[model samples]
Target: MTRKLLHTALVLSLFLPGCRLENLSADQLDLITNSVSSTFKAARPISDEEEYYVGRAVAAKILTSYRLVNNRKLTDYVNLVGQAVAIHSEKPFTFGGYHFAILDSGEINAFACPGGIIFITRGMLDAVSNEDELAAVLAHEVGHINHRDGIGAISQARWTEALTTIGSQAAKTYGSKDVAKLVGLFEGSIDDVFKTLVVNGYGRSQEHAADLASLNYLAATGYDPHALKTFLDRLVARSGGSQGGIMKTHPATRDRVDNVAANMPEQKSDAAHFSERSRRFASILGK
Candidate 1:
């Protein structure tokens, strides 16, 4: 028997009440040991720290394709708006905290990395009419993070293999070959997330769930939840069957708008609040 298996058996023997290690056949011992390991493997979920690392790598990969906005004022404004909504999300905090950035691309797209990194494109910012709309956008992305939609994109088989490798003695020893294998698995995971966020987009169910979550976050943060519906309405009107950027990656705009309207909270209007946020939004992004 392997040293790890033997160690597991010995540990189990000590803890198992009235169970004698010597009484069990070698086959029975091996079966028990394998069952314990399998149980642990099945129960393990990716840690927040691991998700943060994956998010960072995915962010880096995205940056390679789209340059970051060079204007500090614009960057800071986006972060401020993003954090305002994020603080009211289901997950108010993350392992690395939330970081929001703007991509210089004119594509109307946004991406939520696995942990707490969110990216919105210049076109998307322009698409929003006011700060509340921007908050709606950010809230939607935050929903993805709260639900772990990005991490869910990773193939189950790949994740299972990675967990098995991680639990092995070779991984513990950090042998060069094993280290390289781990790196390859990590890269595969990044690819899966990047593709989901940028290329294929999330499934319709995920998009709908995120929209519903966005409404909740917006209402909780004192932003108008109707802003989300309005944004989708604009998308549907502007899209006209065009398949690019967000239209390409997200579900049909009309469907999302319908979902939002169906689940919308009671309407609340504050003209003074609207004007103040609109002024702030225009000062930075323009009307």
Candidate 2:
């Protein structure tokens, strides 16, 4: 009986990779796949050097289509806020001292590349009426950077020699059509430049982890933990049955807000940290 079971298990392992049985239960297969995938990343601090290179090699293509805001003061302001939050992150990352930029757009969006490069859109910045919401948003992006989600996303997408140049960075050219095509596919909506920056939204669990991390970052910086939930709530409201493909990549805003709220640390009056309706972060895009 034991010998027969061993043979069966080996055969199943061999058959599973390309298994295509339309009548098979989707639920059972998903559970099995997720469980198997978990083992490869069962622990924290996903470390793969190749993932970093692939992401770094693709960074320029992602940013090329974005319209940038050249406001020096506003740019500095966002960096200052982002830097403060990044230091407190579990990854505590400082990729070449991480560069941050503000992109000019009205659609809410932000993305972090390998090597600590992060971009925030004018739309998201305009939507945030105060410091707390901005901080919450930035922290969540940092969580992805620190966790190497960029690397994880790329691992699934093979980096062909056609994309990479003779060597690495120095030889690479991002203007290639193939790279942009890949980006279009990943982002899922080629409607606008912002649409091309589709970040691989983590699973529901990863988003929750980002929320918890953002809450901590906010709390450490003397901001209210509830601010995270507040910002996410605003996201849900603004999306209003249409997130324009951006929200489609991220987890449910409502469920995420609830999770962040549950994990918040109790505190006294949040008046000092609360900055709602303050109209702090502004944009040239706003009419």
Candidate 3:
């Protein structure tokens, strides 16, 4: 079987928990192929280097639409919180390592491109009440990067087409045709991730998985596991009827808050941490 088909089979088997892989029938295989084909044409395992380049492209696309925030203190603080949480993530280090930046937009949005390039809008920064809450959000984005959610959005067909064009070329460096094909694939890949992270949002399952991973990062970094829930609660209350920014880009706030509560760790008072962190946050963003 091709790599994309193999991946599809494995993913199908996962959802069937406890079912033997060998038990998969031809009909099931056909079903999987049809379902996947609608969304992807061909796929190959992306290397760390490829992911880094893709991430750079994605970041560049985002920069065209939004300016970077200019506050050095806020930027440094965000990186401090992001790095701390990232160090405790499932994938602690990445090909290019984690880098955090603030977008000047007040859109209450954050994005995690592949290869650990994370961005948070100034609106999101102002929305989070404390350091732990910021850590919670950043950790969730880190989970997306660790899981390679962005790369997974690319249609398998794009990779196959790009590879075919490259293989046809005889030059050591990409010729014009090869470069054009590669650039098209790269642009498609970026659009896939951009549409998910900004336009449509990830599926509920992906969002929940990231939330769980965020909790794990929080626990490992000595932040309150409830920090995410706290932030979500604020989001829910403030959302009132209109959904904007993060609400547009993430799962339902109520469902997420409930899930976090159900899976919350044993109560450990981080009142002191919250107190101290909020002071710093307020100093920067406001009361």
Q: How many Å off is the CA of 124 in candidate 2?
A: 0.4
lDDT of each: 0.83, 0.61, 0.79
Residue pairs with colliding backbones in model 3 are 41-157, 42-156, 42-157
lDDT of 3: 0.79
* Each model's total of backbone clashes: 0, 1, 3
lDDT of 1 at 283: 89
User: Tell me, what's the RMSD of every candidate?
Assistant: 6.7, 12.8, 10.9
lDDT of 3 by residue, 45-84 (tens): 7888889988998899889899998989989989999999
Model 2 regions lying over 4 Å from their true place: 1-55, 156-200, 273-287
lDDT (0-100) at residue 240 of candidate 1?
Answer: 87
Candidate 3 residue spans exceeding 4 A from truth: 1-42, 156-187
Candidate 1 regions exceeding 4 Å error are 1-3, 6-43, 155-157, 160-186
Order of the predicted models by lDDT, top scorer first: 1, 3, 2
* TM-score of every model versus the real structure: 0.80, 0.64, 0.75
Q: Which lDDT tens digits does candidate 2 get at residues 201-267?
A: 5677777887788888878877666767777787788787875634865645787778877888775
- Residue-by-residue lDDT tens digits, candidate 1, 1-287: 77656755654544454556676667655545554454354346889998999999999999999999898999999999899999998899999999999999999999999999999999999899999999999999999999999998874756567656645632122345654675576568788899999999998899999999999998888899999999899898989889889998875577778899999988696889999989999888867
